[model samples]
Every structure is written in C-alpha cells, then in structure tokens.
Target chain A: MNRKLRDLGERRLVEWIVRRLEECEGASLPPGDDAADMLFRGRLLVSCDMLAASTDIPPGMDLRDAGFKAITSATSDIAAKGGKPIAYLVSLMLPPELGLESFEDLWEGFEEAAKLYGGRIVGGDLNSGREIVVDVICIGEAGRTASRLGARPGDILAVTGEFGSQAAGLHALLAGRLEDPEARRVVERFSRPMARVREALELAKTSAVTASIDSSDGLAESLYQLSELNDVGFLIDDPPISAEAERYAEKFGVSLFDLVFYGGEEYELVLTLRSKLVEKAVKAVEGVGGRLIPIGRVIEEKLIKVRWADGWRMLERRGYQHF
Target chain B: MNRKLRDLGERRLVEWIVRRLEECEGASLPPGDDAADMLFRGRLLVSCDMLAASTDIPPGMDLRDAGFKAITSATSDIAAKGGKPIAYLVSLMLPPELGLESFEDLWEGFEEAAKLYGGRIVGGDLNSGREIVVDVICIGEAGRTASRLGARPGDILAVTGEFGSQAAGLHALLAGRLEDPEARRVVERFSRPMARVREALELAKTSAVTASIDSSDGLAESLYQLSELNDVGFLIDDPPISAEAERYAEKFGVSLFDLVFYGGEEYELVLTLRSKLVEKAVKAVEGVGGRLIPIGRVIEEKLIKVRWADGWRMLERRGYQHF
Candidate 1:
C-alpha cells in the first residue's frame, strides 16, 4: 500500500522533515523552535518569491523541478544584490491528495538547491491547499550591496553567460518536443536555473560594479527596470545569444531577438559598471569560471536602442508580466 | 472603468505598491533592492506561514482580513520565541481577475498588522495565480529566546487568554449565524487574531518561563507537541474557554470541551514555567496588560490527563491536522 500525506498527519510530516535536514551554516536555532534563530555578521539581505503550480509550472515539469526553481528564483534576487545566501525559509501549500513520496522528493530537491547554494533550510510552513504552491524566502548577508539605482549614464551594460535558452526551452516544452536533445537542454535551463551568486559576489568585491539585477524577467525587462530605477537608458551593440539557444530558436522557428529580449527565468546577472574597470570586472567574473559579456552602455537618451548588422532600431520596453 | 490587475500590469502594480509603502523601521535596504536589508541587534528570529483562500478563509471574510490573518499567524511564531518583530516579507499569489482596489485593501491590512506588531513590510514577491495566496515571512530579534523543548517535569503549565473563540467563530461562520452578538465577537476574534508578542516579551525577561508555543493547532495539539518535545506530560485542571466562546458553543449546541480542545488558530501563547515563579510570570503578563492563566502542571509520566469536577479522564492526543 502506498502511504499518503494524510496517513502521516501534519505534525508527523513536519517531524520527518526536521529529522532529514542537516544543520546549515549561520543557523543558531533549527526547526524544533517556534522560529529558527540565526546570527548574521553584517547587513541581512532578504528576498521572497512564490511559485504557483498553475502559473509558474509549464508542461513537462514535475514537483522536483518546481521545488528547485522556487529556491533558485528567490536566490537570484539575493545574488542580484551581491549577497551570500545563508538561510532559507520555505512555505509550501500542498494539496491533500499529494503523495508522501512526492512530498519527500520535493523536499529533497529543495534541500539539494539550498546545499548547492551554500544556504540551509532553517525553517518552513506547510498548509493544505488546492494546488502546489512553493514560496521561498531567502536570507543573506552583504558588506556593500549593489543597487539598481546606482547605474550612471556612461556605465557599461553587461550580462553573465547567455540568454534565450529559457525562452527556447519554454517554447520547446509548449510544442511537445520533449525528446529532442536541444529541447531537453533548454528545458533543463528553464527547470534548473542557477543563481549567479558566485559571479555577483566576485563583482561586488570590486568598486567597478554599479547596478546589478538578475534576469528573471528577461533582459529587456531587467534593463527597463534598471533604466527606470536610475533614470537612464541603454544602447545595445551586441546581444549575447547562447549557441544552444540559437540552435533551439532556429529549430523551433522562433525569432532570436524575441527569444533573447523577452525570455524570462534565465537567472543570469545583468549589470552596469564603470567603463574604466571593465577589465577588472571581467577578470573577477572569470575568476569564478564565468564570463562577463558586455552587451551595451548606459546612455543619457532615456530610450533603449539596439544595433543590428542591417540597421539600428528602438526596442519596445516589454517583457513578461504576471498580471 | 474599473482597473483589473491585468490592466495595470505587474510592473505598474509593483510601482504602486512601492509608492504606498512608508519607510519601514530597521530596513537598511528597502523594497527597491533585490532583497531588503536589515541590521539586528541580537539573534535573528525567523518564521514563515502561508494562507490559501480555499482553506484558510471562511465565509464572509474579505481580502483585508485574509492579509491580516496571514501576517498575525506568522507573528504568533515569533511571539512564541519571545522575539521582537523587526521586518516582514510577504509573497502574494493573486488571481488575474482580482481588482486593484481589493489588492490595495489586502496590502493595507497587511501593513496595518505589521505596524501594530511593531514591525513593517520591508519587501515582498507578487505573482499571478488561480487564487489568492498570502505567504508571510517574519524576521525578529531575541536576546534570550524561548524553546518548546525547555519544559521540565513539575513545571507549571499556563496560557495567555482564552481558547475556543476561534473555533466558535468558525462554527458560527459555517452555520451562517453572523448576526448574533456573541457570534460576531467570536467571528471577529477568528478574523483578526492578535499574536501574543507583548506578553511573551515580558515573560522572557524573567527566568521563570521554560517552554513556549503558539496555540495554532488547538490546545490539545499544542500540548501534545510540547509533551513530545520536552519528554513530559501535562495534567490539566482548568481549560480556559472564553465567556463568548462558551455562549457560542451553548447556542450552537456544541460541546464546550470539544470547542476548547479542538479549535485552532487561537494565536494564544501556551507556556510552561517553574512552579515557584508562577506569580512572577502572572505579574509580568499583567504588566503588559495581559493575563496569564495557569491551567496545568508538567509530570514525568508520558500520558496527558485532564481533571474535571466529576472525575479524571485521559485526554486523547487529537487536534486539527492539515492532511
């Protein structure tokens, strides 16, 4: 007979979860207390993100990927602030029919992500709901944090890794191309997006970096946010499209520009920095085994412009919107 | 024309929310950053809770009460730890059809609760979903924290305020008895439950208190949790049922004992303290304009017993379970 969540009861389930968690760094009090206690060395950074099954999960995704995506998405925000993640508190709204095995798998994936990012699952809340909803609240620390409002007109605009992969992945998934290798890779990119913590931490150590944001809302949306926050604009000469994404876009007959500019959940770091320290920033990211790809420069025009081989065109300020 | 969430767009909605938020206390970095930053003077206490519309909200309850309940429920955990609330992060999963006015009202209620508890809404995540789901993560500070595992054999068991009110309220709501004064009071109690932060902080100042927990899962369930954690049992002589709850129970033809023992979401603090310092604990609670009602004593035995005027009976370990 298969055991269900109802068989174990809420308290028993919580006890089982508590037993499975290893002691995480910076945690003074763990799961058994009314609240987890932590000691932070400096300024505490906190970010929260919620993933709903109906809105966040696409086709060909399971609970484990949902769990992983939830944490990384929140951690990406912390990374954008150039903060080192210390602890996470996850609140799960699970349906009653959810199996005990599935719950364990979800938790395993959640714990795996926390360990990979050097953060611990310090506490959480579980409640019955109509669908699976995972809300992750991440806590971190930073000595000096980067802000979106710190970008200047003459700053260089850069991004880590490449874009359009997640968008391509979503397109493939929606098109039911699950077995294709390129589709699988892009789907994996969408499902298991990694936070740019290492690169952001390295960049934060230098005085070169000004404004930073994680590209959870696509490159164009992120640039628009940076522009709005700092009252500036961007002039893009190059758009970094990953080779795999390029292939997937071509195979799926999707526009490369649309994929790169409007694809959300990339989890790449988009940053602005002083032009003089470009080499230093590049070297710092390289030290972390990541490349800082400069795509554009902050401009005083207050309108985004992108240059192509044929001509220059003004890009519409559009991206994913939840509502 | 009425504005729907979809009409305003996520970015515009967020901008509206940011504009509405006043500068919160202890927030080094506020809403616009990747993560809100805070400086803690002592050990940071953290707790998270999620409320779903399908399960948590009752009949006739609006969005404002839902938001208030979400924060206060989480605040109860911090209070159980005898921590002073500093900041709160709320992640809301809202349906697209939800109006802008309703969203604003929900946020107003959330902010109201935070301010009332001496905390503030520093940051949050908003996403589209099928239903309204509020996940609240609270961060607080404590110099000397209370734990559920601290109860000792022979300690006196006490609770702040009465029980069964929330249960009575739920019953009345379900029965459609919203017009009665007693029902109204209980419904109000259930709708706007206050966390016992002030009383817990006062009790923490003295060395009298040992174990502490919030009565979120009804009296029996909370006691069972305390018993399991401390490796002890409780012998109860008095069950604190409020007069309003008693009247509501009688009016509804429900057992008073059942209502008191099985009703959840009370947000009352259940605590165990040294026998000699019961008076001191009571005085401390009184100093904070609250009352500490002694109900039982801890025993070395592993079974819980309840004494009535007629006879003594063993209390079954049963309460509300989400599954």
Candidate 2:
C-alpha cells in the first residue's frame, strides 16, 4: 500500500498502451480516449479491462462486486461506443491470501452482471502475481460508434438518468450514513453500474445524436472530452439531481452541484444531440427504456459555461480527475 | 518476491489476466502462457514480456544488451515454434529515476537488436513502474510450428550453437573475471542472445523436425518436456557445453553438468529430429547459417536420462527459474 506507483499516471499509461497495441495489425485507435476499436465480427460487443487491486480497485465492499463491477465497467465503455455487449473477458488477478470462496463469488457476480446486461461471461485468465491486477479486455461491434468529436456547435446536451446520486451516496455511506436504507441504492450504483448499451445503440442509429461519452469519470470529465474533441463550448444548465443526492449532499456537507459535476463512477452517459431532432433523440433513447434529460446545449464559445438564473460562470474543472 | 507467481505468483497473475481478457472474437489464450493471442490481419504469433530489474536482467547491464536480450527473450519462443519474426512491439517500463540518456541508450540498443534479428521496432510504450519491466511482444508467422508434442520415440536430440555459455559468462562478469577476455563470449551469449529462428525455419521447411522447445530453459528441462510430450525417453551421450565451461565449473566449485544441463537463457533450439534426416537436417540448418549439433537420441521408454562416466542418471530439479 505504501508503494506510490511512481512514474506515468493512468492517462500517460493509457497513451503508451494505445500506441503499442495499435501497432498490432488489428488495434483500433493507436492510443487516446475511451475504448479501443474492435474489428466488428458479430453484432455483439466484447470489452476488456485490467485493474490492479492496489492501484485500481480499492479495499472490499463485496467480493461479488468485483465481478459485477468488472462487467459493468466494460459495458459502460461499450455503451459509450453505441454497441451492445455480447460477451466479456475477466482476467482476475488473485493474490495468495485469497480463498476459493472469493473466486466463486467473483464468478457469481460476473454471471449476475452479464445476465443483468444482455451479455454472458465467456473465457478469461486466472493468473497469480505480486499484486492483484485484473485485466478485462473486451470485444465490441458498433452499429455506429458515437465519437466524442461528433457534436456540432448547436447540439443539445443530454444525460441518461440522474447525476450525483452515487457521489453523495458514497460519501454518506463512508460517513456512516447507514441509517438510510436508500444508501444501498447509492452503493449499488457504484457497485453495479448498468451500461446503457441498448440506449447507445438506439441513439447511434438515429439522426438526432451528435456525440456521446460514458460518465464513468463524472459528468464534467465526459463533457470535457466531448467539447475537446468537437472543439465546441457548452452552455449547460445544471441537470436535476437525484433525491438521494440532495439528502446525501446535505449530510456530507458537499455541494449538490459538485456531486452532479465532479462525482464519478456513475456509469451513465452524457450525450450531445442535434438540436432540431432533440425530441426525436429523447424518444429514441426512451424507447429503449432509457431516460434522456436535456441538460444544456453546445455553444460557439470555446468554454464549458454553466448558465444559471443568477449569472454565467466558468467551471473550475471540466472533467473527472482520472489520475 | 518469495511468493510463487501461480500461487499468487506469475501464474495467478497470468490467469487473472486471462479471465479479464476472456475470449473476444479475436483474443487467443487470453492472459495465459508467455503471450496472448491477438487477432491481427495475418496468421500472426504475438507475445509480450516484461523484464524486471533484479529478477529478469541483473542490475547494470548495458542498455543495448538489455534491448538485445529483450528481443531475444521473446524471439526464442517464436523460434521454438519454428516461426519467423515479422515485427516486434517494445514496451520499456522505465523507473522515473532514469532520464533521457538512459532512454536514448535503451532505444539505441532496442533498434540495433531489432535490426539484427530482422524485426523492426514498430511501436512501444514508455511508462514508469515499480521495476524496469521491458515487455517485448513479438509477432511472427509459422511455416510449420515445431510444437512441443510432435516428437516420437526415434527422434534424435539436436541443438543449435554451444550451451552453458550464458550462465558461466554471467558468473565471470559478476565475479569481475573480465581479465579473462574469453569470458566475454559467455557474457555476449547472455547479453546478445540470438534466436534459433533460422534453424527452426529451415527445419520446418524440410519437415525434418518432430518436436521442438527452446533450450533457453536448458537441455534437461527441454529433454523432460520433449519426452513428456512424445511419451518417449531421452538419452544424451554428451550434451553440448560452452567453451570455458570447465573453467567456470572449477571456479564456481559447481558441477559443469549442472550449468550445461539445467542452466537457461540459452535461446538455442532443442529440436527433435528423425534418425533418418541427420545429414539433411545438419545441411539444412547449416545452409541457413545455423550450425546444428546433434546431441543424443530418443528411446522407447519414458525415462529422461543423462549419461555420465559411470552410467545414466535421471535429473532431479528440472530447469531455469524466472523468479
């Protein structure tokens, strides 16, 4: 735990990985943001992820969550790419201290998560090492990939489901806020994130959407990616926060807007859509059992401005601090 | 460091990786073995390995040798499979303490090594981590892979180049025996190991080899593997030992047999050949500039024995220890 993991952070590490893997004959994008490209085979998608326990996943809440979170984590990227999860790989790094029970629970969670989504857990690794580093690389095919750069200046900004609940809920739970049974919802939000694969696919097929990104890191970070890629500004009106978030925000003494903007692990999607077909886009997303809430619109200026009744202000941090 | 990698040792980590990387349409042997299978455009063979400082490469070796050795380390497996390298992916995980000079030196060594081995350093990843782990993932094509299980009872044991040089050379360098410049040969053997790709390929083209495994893990381990795979026996009259091996034996007070039979990182091909193709095989490999040394013969029984002055004896502990 004392080891600082000196040198390149995740961003730089990812950049390096992209560069190397992309050189392979089938590597999708050399190295950059989001997910790597898969040479589409079946309409289904598969994604992979590796998490070093010391560096990636924190100390336990539930072991099964490892499996569930792994699946959901991969599925979230699939959702961002406007693809459906057909299957996933789960290479679990088991430390020597672990037991058979943990492995069984991990597999169980994997099965549960897959059934929750539409995919199944296929084959993966069971490697041992100094640290617990779980790598899950997935395969995904897109009907149409929703790139972050696809947003136009006038595109309508949107989000799937509510924001900030997980952040507030996590904070409250950490602060011994177990008095509220609904705190389980927030914990579950973090533990069992649902990838909006169907919604992403449906939206991608429509003419209404422009750009999309998964809100794994948080709303601000996802939006920053969209703006940076598209070279556009966002005039966002803070979207409606969840009830759990408002209560948890008060209990944790953290700002509701902060939770909405900077809180991460939401696994929801923040998307930009064509202004003229905003209604159509919403309908398309909702048609697939996903809620699309219009949060803002793209502006000509090269800034992500938060516009409220009081005044217009600049966001201090545009995205999630993944590193 | 004391931990067995599979018992949360390297094997466990590898299995964890396998689980996470679970089979997509493209990924092969996910996170298992030396390298994972990649679905590149061609019938490509790719493997990535990370060399650690203390564990893999001893401290203070030349950057060029490190680079050369890295390439050799990977190419050896391909050679065993009777494959020709097309290209390499080099990921040099540097400690932050290292600077531009070290990087340049490493790059120079890497480029030169790649060039010498007929592979291009197409791309790489540079990141800071705990140890200096240089991962080299090589991609090659097979005319016919000299798999581990192809040998039969009558197959003759063969090798390329002299053995025991690397271990003895390393010992001399570590003991400051540089005054004996002959030790340089062994040192060079370790630092600048060349793959037996040429020999493997030539053998494959002639269809002379029954089974093959790189002698990197030494003749004893290879014999054990080949015998196990073919359900045969191995009887070596006098396995090849490097020049100065006897001197090293005297200096270190170790049995010369131990260094030659069980020592590793040789990177020479321990190919199994039919008794009939001895001359043709020798000519075939020598024509490709790979000198073939026929060492022993296979037997009907399943015992793997080495001949000594007294009689034949079975080896106890098998081969090289990467840990």
Q: State the lDDT at B152 in candidate 1.
A: 88
Task: Tell the DockQ for candidate 2.
Answer: 0.08
Model 2 chain B — which ten-residue stretch has the worst lDDT?
A: B28-37
Ten contiguous residues with the weakest lDDT in model 1 chain A = A21-30
lDDT of 2 by residue, B1-323 (tens): 23322133222332332343223234322222112223344333444444555555665468768877878877777677777776565543344455445555666776676677676544332333344556565556664455676677777888897777777767766776666666665676677778877787788877788877777667777777667657888788876877677666776676777878777777888878888888899999889777999888888988877777588878664564321
Tens digit of lDDT per residue, candidate 2, span A1-323? Answer: 22222232322322332342222224322222111222323343334444444433545456688677767776787677676665454444344455546655666777787778776443332323355444443445565455555677878898888887877756665666556766666766666667787778778878676777778768777776667667888998766587777776676578888888887778887888888888888898788888889988898787888864488868765443211
Model 1 clashing residue pairs (backbone): none
Residue-level error in angstroms, candidate 1, position A123: 1.0
After superposition on all C-alphas, the RMSD of every candidate to the true structure, in Å, is: 1.6, 10.5
Work out the iRMS of candidate 1: 1.6
True lDDT of residue A199, candidate 2: 79
User: What local lDDT does model 1 show for residue A177?
Assistant: 87
The per-model DockQ list reads 0.75, 0.08
